[model samples]
Target: MTSASAFWIAAVRARETGRGAPLFIDPFAHDLAGDYGYATMAASERVAGGENAFIPVRVRWFDDLTMTSAAAGVRQIVLLGAGLDTRAYRLDLPADADWYEVDRREIFQHKEPVLAEHSPRCQRHIVIADLGGDWAEPLLHAGLDPAARTLWLAEGLFFYLTEPMIVDLLHTAAALCGPASIVAADIIGTAGLDAAAMRGYRDWCDRNGVPPPFGADDPAALLHAGGWRAEHITTPGAADANYGRLPIQPGGRQPGRTHLVTASLATS
Candidate 1:
C-alpha cells in the first residue's frame, strides 16, 4: 500500500473496534476503509498483536470534542492533515454546516476516488494541498468564508511537523478564522518522545516509509503563543473519563503526556 493508503488502513482498524457499540461508533469509517483497501490493514494489525489499539480510543475522544464544539455554535469544520478521516461522513451536523478536509495531493488522490464511490451524508468539501506549503490559499479560494464561525481540527498531524511548521499552520488558521473560532489538536509532550515511545514511533514510521518529526514540550503554551487561547486540555485518562471508558495503561508504546487540546482564536 502507498503511504496515503496506509493512513486509511490504520483508521479502519480504529473505527471497527474503537467505534463499535460501546466506543465511538463511526459506521462510515469502517465502510470507507473496506472500500479503500483498509480491510487488509486491519487484518494485519489483528495478527500483529493489535498494533493500533489507541486509534479508536483517540478518534472517539476527538469525535466527541469536535461535536461538542459544534454544539456550542461552530458551523464550519476544517480538518487539517485529514488523512483518510471519515468524520465528515460519519458525524451528524446541521444541514448548512460545511466540512472542509485538507491534506496532501496524494492523500486526496487516494481518498477522492473511494469517497466518490460512497458520497458523504453531509456537506463535504476536499482541499488538496500540502500543509507545509501554501495550502491555505486554496482553502480561501474554495469559499471557506473566514468570517464565519468555524471549528478546525488538526488531529494526528502536529507531531509529524516541525516547530516552525506548526507555528505557521496555527498563525495561518488564526488569520483565516473569525472570532469565537475553535481549533482542536492533539499533541505529545517531551516525555512522550522518550526512548521507548520514540523507538515505537520510529518503528512505525520506518514501516510506513516516512520520517518522524519533533514533538512539543508544552503545546498549550505553543498554541497560546500562536494567538489562540487554550480552552480545554484533555489527556488520555481525561478523555477516557469524558467518554466513559476505563483508563488506558499508563505506559504504552505511544508517547507520554499526549493530550487533546481545544483553543479559541484570540480576537485582536
Candidate 2:
C-alpha cells in the first residue's frame, strides 16, 4: 500500500475538488487517491468530523506562491516529498518552466498510470530515491540547474524529519540553488503539537508508521542558524486572518501553530 499520510492528504484534495468553490482545484486528486482515498475520507469523518481544512488551505497557499514566484521569472520547481501531489498536472506554467519531484520509486508507481491518463501542465521529471540520502546527483542528472532560480516546496514533510536532516536539506539547497531561489514549506512549532488538530494528526501519523519526531518553536531562528534568510513566517490557525477557518475539536481550540515558512539562502 502507499503511505498512510499519502492517502489522507489526497483525500483532502479530493474533497476540495468536489466542492463548489474550493480554495484550489486539483483535477487528478480523486483518481490518484483511488478507492482507498475516498474510504480514508469516510473513515476520518466517522473518527473525526470530516477532514480538517488545514491541509488544503496550505496547499492553496503554496500553489499561489508558486505561480507568484514563477511570474517573477522562477522557472524551476522542486517538490521534495511529492507524494500524491497533483500540482505538476494542475497548475498553469510558463513555457520555459520545468518541474522535479524527488521521492521513492514506490511513490511514482502510484503516479505513472495517473499521468498516463492526465497531462502535466509543465515539463516534469521524477527522481526516484530516498530523500535522506545522496539524491542530489540524480536531481542534476534529471536536468535541475543548481545555479538557476527555483521554487521548492516540502509541505507536510518536515515534522517527520529530524532537525539534522532538515538542516542538511537547507544546506543542500543553499549549495545547489542560486541566490534568488525561494523555498516554501511547513514546519511545526513546539506549541502546535498540543493543538487538538495536530494531536489527532500526530496520532494518525504514529498509527500510520510515520511519527512526529521534531517541532521547532522559532523557524526564523532555525533558518538563521541554518544560514538562510527568513523572508516571511505565518501560522494559519484557528480563525487565522487569511484562511478564516477555525479548527474545532471536541471542546478545546488553540492555534494551528504551523509555520507556513518562506525563505531563501542568504548571500555570503
TM-scores across all candidates? 0.81, 0.87
- Lowest lDDT block of 10, candidate 1: 246-255
Q: Who wins the TM-score comparison? A: 2
| Alpha-carbon lDDT of model 1 | 0.71
Name the top lDDT candidate. Answer: 2
Model 1 lDDT tens row, 182-245:
8888787677565453565567777977657567756677898778988877666553423455
User: What lDDT does the true structure give each of the candidates?
Assistant: 0.71, 0.77
Task: Note each model's CA RMSD in angstroms.
Answer: 4.2, 4.1
Pairs of residues at least 3 apart in sequence or in different chains that clash in candidate 2: none
**Candidate 2, superposed: residue stretches over 4 Å from native:** 44-50, 195-211, 237-256
Error of 1 at 153 (Å): 0.2
- Superpose all Cα atoms of candidate 1 onto the true structure and report the RMSD in Å to 1 decimal: 4.2
Q: Give one digit per residue, the lDDT tens place, for model 2 in 1-268.
A: 2365687788789888788777888878878888887786777666565566677778888888988998999999999988888888888888668999988888889878887966788889999978689989999999999999888888888877878888888778777788688878777667756755455667766897864657887787777666688888776653332454544322112234567778888875
